[model samples]
Target: MRTRKSETELPRFGEAEALRLDAADPGHRHLFHVPPADGGRHPESAYLAGNSLGLQPRATRDELLADLDAWGRLGVEGHLEAERPWLPYHELLTAPAARLVGALPTETVVMNSLTVNLHLLMVSFYRPTGTRTRIVIEDSAFPSDSYAVRSQARFHGLDPDTTVVRLTPRPGEDTLRTEDVTAFLAAEGDTVALVMLGGVNYLTGELMDIPAITAAGRAAGAVVGWDLAHAAGNVPLSLHEWDVDFAAWCSYKYLNSGPGALGGVFVHERHHGEPDLPRFEGWWSTAAATRFEMTPVSRPPSTVEAWQISNPPIFSMGPVRTSLELFDSVGMPALRDRSLRLTGYLERLLDEVTADRPLTVITPRDPGRRGCQLSVRLGEGSARELTKRLRYEHGVIADAREPDVVRFAPVPLYSTYHDCWRVADALAATVGRAG
Candidate 1:
């Protein structure tokens, strides 16, 4: 909550202004642990990497320990006797996760990791037949999706290079345009079997036009699915209303679960009871009431739970529950409001800092087209090296992509206005102006 004095203070841009903004609009930073600075005069690091991984909630430790203690006391009985019973532990997360992403509880389930859920959802949705064997994704998609789709192509005995269509931005553009995507589908949609893309691009931080794209893909007769790894907790979504066929998202980032936490999947109610849909199932895939029958064959539910393949790790569910509860208590509408204000402030600071520097903000200028993250591409220095200098010398925690991009996310739940000012300050100090 403290602001440092700066000799570079100007009329519109100054650390004092940042402090006043924080005093007027404080986030829920007290609920989480802001890491100690590794290298600057400031005691706390300017943590801005939530797009990669979120800070741990203070409640996570105590809540996780409680789950552990239940096991120690009740042994196998913990399955039914624990405070938050293990047998139905995942059920605790269903509605809240559903609310967070704007889906019916029957249409959502927290299950495996992000990419695993993608592959599983693809099994049921990505049905390639005849000439419609192609899968569409953006060129800047996170690498895991590229691998998943490519492997899917190969599994069907198709060439990944040809079967996977990567939509690239136009000449000199850093992000894809929705009109371009829809036009591509209009021209080439019949050849595409599935359209899967990141709801928000990982590198450029572009929040794609989900509803428009989903409508286009469906109108083109292609199944549309989104990897909301970056969009889930960052932006508001309405998968059910969007008429999306399927979607998946990881919890580790904006969801604020620990590293590699379980992910959530959404399958529209329309797809739930389709008799011909092939799904990989296990005991957990069956209805809870029928789960203990021990029958040779499974009776899968007519809900999204039918996609779940295994009993989730209860310990992992604890952190996700803790984080989702925080989201539920504060609500996405409030967080998003703060996000727009916080990110807008950061953009202004970067505007001043990069005015004479060789840095370029690659994320879209429109707040409506992006989330909490702002990505900058350096014109001279290595982004990796720039981040290192920002960290060791200035105590700013940021994420860098190889070549020349660095990402900063001013998460509304915890990131402060001072955090944004530090990013601008660090950039100015580390990357000297282009003279």
Candidate 2:
């Protein structure tokens, strides 16, 4: 529903009017049944950290039990004999996940952790020849991504300081502008080998224009890759249609897989025929038909499965499968619709409560420019103490970045409208008390 304010009063979000969001939440659990330490009824701890780690899905437990049962019942033969056989299990996830990211099943696969997947995709896509040796990354890219790109440059016998270009926003701007990014690509096109960037910057919640960036990179003859840790599930994507060379993302965040759960990687179908693409391979990458032949030489599959280096951890993947089902049930469109409403509501509430306060939201005010997260920049020394008080006194849970930024993400699947109101109330109280 569209929101508006009357001629006199400020706009107020009507939680009751929201489209039965909680009723449709697939992962609903009885968190309120737990008794508080004070022997009072325990309220749900306004969880807004889906950008960091998602809540456990209600179905995850059963999915895990079924897998464990397969392991116990069939033993070694479970590879082929058990239902959803262990050997071909990862294949079952391919189509649905591909649909999620708007890629062909042949172009996607579940694999290692986010950082590991990034490195793997880099090995295949970041081929640096004489003239095309430089890499482009954003200045505000996540630390893990920065480290990974630096290591890739170093491994190629190139000085990271010279080979990796960190694209910064224009002076005094908090987020990068697409025009600036394109200008840089145009200026340095000939020397740039890879254009690797975060689909959504972690700290700022800036959703970079992926299709535009990909076009610039490809036009400049540079391969493009993306780290979707903060973008996947938070926004709609079309990795294939965008002609992105490759990408990787974790399931633990918006996908609601458990913390440190296995991640996925996407390699454009165009690369499937390039068997000679340099990759660090293992047995799991071998052709499934000949995999059990146990030959010494590896014959990789003709798809993204060729990127896998080892067997996936079944337990970790269980939560991924569980969480994905919830995503599938509600669908990304419905989930995102609610996400926008919830986050927009919270942003307005924050603005209202901090009318006379020192806190400022660094995240973009335009809904299309941000994810569900909002990063508030507090005054010096205020972030640390304010965050502590919110946790202990207000029954809220939010994360604080170093220096002065505090981030809160109101996940649509679990967080409610009242939670946003309470957090704003607590923040106002905390700031007032400190004053």
lDDT at 97, model 1: 97
Give candidate 1's whole-model lDDT. Answer: 0.93
Range of the 10 consecutive residues with the lowest summed lDDT in candidate 1: 1-10
Error of 2 at 373 (Å): 1.0
Best by TM-score: 1
- Candidate 2 TM-score over all chains jointly: 0.91
Worst 10 contiguous positions by lDDT, candidate 2: 31-40
TM-score of every candidate: 0.97, 0.91
What TM-score, to 2 decimals, does candidate 1 have?
0.97
Which stretches of model 2 miss by more than 4 angstroms?
1-42, 433-435
Candidate 1 structure quality by residue, lDDT tens digits, 125-176: 9899999999999999999999999999999899999999999999999999
